[model samples]
Target chain A: MANVPKLSDPQSELLDKVDVFIFDCDGVIWRGDSLIDGIAETLERLRKAGKKMFFVTNNSTKSRAGYKKKFDGLGLTDVPAEEIFSSSFAAAAYLEQSNFPTDGSKKVYVIGEVGIGEELDLIGIPHLGGPADNDKVANMGSGGRLEVDPDVGAVIVGFDRDVNYYKIQYAQLCINEGDAEFIATNLDAVTHLTDAQEWAGNGSMVGAIRGCTGQEPTVVGKPSPLMIEYLESKYGMDRSRICMVGDRLDTDVLFGTDNGLKSLLVLSGVTSEEKLLSPDNSITPDFYADDINAFFASETATV
Target chain B: MANVPKLSDPQSELLDKVDVFIFDCDGVIWRGDSLIDGIAETLERLRKAGKKMFFVTNNSTKSRAGYKKKFDGLGLTDVPAEEIFSSSFAAAAYLEQSNFPTDGSKKVYVIGEVGIGEELDLIGIPHLGGPADNDKVANMGSGGRLEVDPDVGAVIVGFDRDVNYYKIQYAQLCINEGDAEFIATNLDAVTHLTDAQEWAGNGSMVGAIRGCTGQEPTVVGKPSPLMIEYLESKYGMDRSRICMVGDRLDTDVLFGTDNGLKSLLVLSGVTSEEKLLSPDNSITPDFYADDINAFFASETATV
Candidate 1:
């Protein structure tokens, strides 16, 4: 058998060429509520080394302002708001630039809370369902009234607390009857939190509609070209020089691998060693590290 | 607008009689960590009313034993292990019965964990990726230097944490190179936890591979006729009398709609109101309730 190169034993030479370090929060920096070991020191050390580092988190729960507060609380004050990228921001920016057909009367049915809803408003997209909207609806099989907005033009799938069967059914009817385009904030199926385990991300919601309508959605989050394009436009870095680091392989590593960038998988969060060794792996990281501190200390100077 | 018939509205009196009550676990009974209010009491009430209720969660994370423990913890002690139906069990039973082209020497690349993996082992399917097997090497990725089992017959997709790009690429290669049939445990896009959000279910993982290989998978989960058939065979109930209850409209409600059964959507979980009103709505539930308890208490009982 030929000696095929495994990522675990990276030729040591490929490790030195990274220029931009894209860090995924939640898993790499902090799992849920607490910071990973030596993550703050790792960021400071990387900043001192003059590496162009940015925080790329797919979590849409918090806005950039919230992230800034989280970073400051975690002792990562060097990075500014502009250096942080979130799916919420990317979704908003993509909507702004996207040439999808929209009518002044057309409504964007949003399923998210303040952050995602606010982003749609900021982009001048008209939305239908929200806290104040009287013409509210819910999915079928959920035991809610199906209030169909006949004038709806698009369905934007986001995270929400009050989702129901009536809501899903109404969304389906719109797609089937209105021929509306669909967009999801992200394809992440689950979000990892501080205290609890993982929950469904936009992908789950997207899957439901897609399965029913047989239409794929235009995703605008991590690993999606939209988020990456937004980041590249702002950061002015070649895609090849950027590396995506996180604890889970599907989102972070898959994002990096899909975009032809290096992925570094850390063992400090959601994914375990048993998963890494499974035969059904769909995402493979370019590099594997114990923690961000070790990755920064060992690979920073080399890169 | 002429009174639009609200299929999900309990007050609409769409369902006058109850036949079979199918339940999904994640959001309807409980969101992530705890049970939704009034679920046990409602189930008990419905049980006392002599309704045929079956707990049918699509989550492949746990087995019958695991779900039994969870249901017992919730104090719904009326159900037995035989009542639960998981995707893994469905896949295992299907593979066991359908004379799938396994020559005993044919290698099987298992993409999921214990739920799916253990089932394959129990069915005498030769696994290729474990430590003990070298003759038929199984890995997450399809492209590799290892001895590609010449007798490889099928590529399986399951809920795997170790999934990576290489694994998908490898699976694609195996299918293209060896002409192996592609099979998936389920097409769930997200799995829910109580407190956290959703995680990428097997659907997205399969999508990544399908994007490359241009091959669709043979799915074995809810909404798949195989599962419905298996249930019908085991339970001996008329398919028309079954009512599927879940949080998301895409899977649970759609399953019912597609199979000519009644579907109920619960607000205690993933599907949201905005989604139902969106132009893209597809899967409309037959009925809706704030939660399972409300279904029985409200007009859902007679309607």
Candidate 2:
């Protein structure tokens, strides 16, 4: 376990003394295929100073292996594949701990991409729909998407670029009629990558399904206990001593606040000063800075 | 608005159908204590000619108001109010309209009595606490009831027999919350009578406060638009041509099903076997038969 000191609420007063700098990839390190401002240099400086750091993103649009390749292309070549954590992986870990029905014969319905679907397969939880041999895709077009069938007991929702009415309807039907338990990989309403336009993320879909079924899903990403659970299982991190450094409040700040860990919100992402003032954004950050490099430059103690 | 038919799918198919009987009260005849069953021998003998009927029960408690009153004591004396409808008025209506928040209010922080609280209240919408004022009077000695809080946006529920902690919480903070909405004047959860047993009604209290709010309530009376909205609002109903008849879906089957013309659920109080088996229980009936009295014993016609 890392010998991180326990910081009182007092420690959160300063903006520095953050030894482990975690960056959220999609909106922080890079957006789509392009790197964000000073991101590459920040990573180099943080590493040279012997500070431990990692990139954690809840975006399940790509697999861990895919993220590794993207990072190498972005010139953050020294970052290890092990440092990348995605909500899809967190979801898989959650299912594993939950003793998910993993018999090869049991089919699990997935409403997401290769990253999410592949995670289910790796964990031995069968995918109900996908291109894999065991997959049982509904292909309901845009209208049948929300139609739920009892045969599908578990629903895995992730970021899908091609969401249409049919998918929503089929998923709704599955949830309302089939009584399928629902899970979303993350709660993001939109991702900054793939252009700056807003797109519905898992939260919007979950809201629609909840409207009909009166069910709230267990989100598997940051801010959700499942992510922390996965981290503990993978690295044996001391739950009380760890801290989360990321940009977004909905994900990173929420993750830290909800789990009792310290959070550092970087100003390099989609969230802004105005958003922090809103009552709906329940979580508050422990520290903030322009980027990873500036964080260490301040050299201010957390307390 | 579409010219949709009001009967349930099964009942709608039998165009000129009228073979049984049922009823619900609250809205059909009287507002609170006033009798809407009316003064007419016209209410009896719908079954003597061999029409089958039985009251569909949603109340779960009470056995036949001991078998009938209100009308018997009010000197509209020819009929029986017990034979009109089951006390599960709110539940039956809600079951039909389990959709979205008609406004933005989601969870109902209820406080009231047995008929208004337990079974019916919990069916679809999530409820935060026990039913209010009236319900306390109804369920004394049962145990400690959950208290209501300001976080609750809507207070729906009814009557009570031993009002105390539950009622205080409801009447004080829950309703006083600025944005909170109050529902329920169907105040009489259980009406005490000449004998030891009590009869339940949602008048008195529900009616009193409604007068103050001036927000004409969506009363779940014997047969109000509220009940019909279940079928018509969702499935579409033909108001001009449809008819309802019963001893009681609430007070009378024909109440909401009546559509301003023929609302009659026959006597023997609530319902009969023929009414239970007929499609109108799910649809709408044209006429009624109380006990052995059939109103249109030898006729085949539309209202």
| Clash tally, candidates in order | 75, 111
Residue-level lDDT tens digits of model 1 in A114-157: 55666666556777664343234332133323447777777777
Tell me each candidate's i-RMS in Å: 13.6, 23.8
Number of clashes in model 2? 111
Residue-wise C-alpha lDDT for candidate 1, range B1-303, written one tens digit per residue: 112223454423423455678788788777655778777887776677667766776566566666788888887787787777777667667776677645587667655556666656667777654222212323313232333566667777766544432344346557766778788777775443213323345665565446445567888777687767776787787877678888877778888888888777777787666665456776677666667766545555666
lDDT of prediction 1: 0.64
Candidate 2 DockQ category?
incorrect
Question: What are the per-candidate TM-scores when only chain A is compared?
Answer: 0.78, 0.75
Interface RMSD of 1: 13.6
RMSD of candidate 1 to the truth, in angstroms, is 16.9
The weakest ten consecutive residues by lDDT in model 2 chain A span A1-10
Candidate 2 per-residue lDDT, tens place, B115-195, comes to 444434434545554433322331222232333444555555444323222343343344443355665433333332212
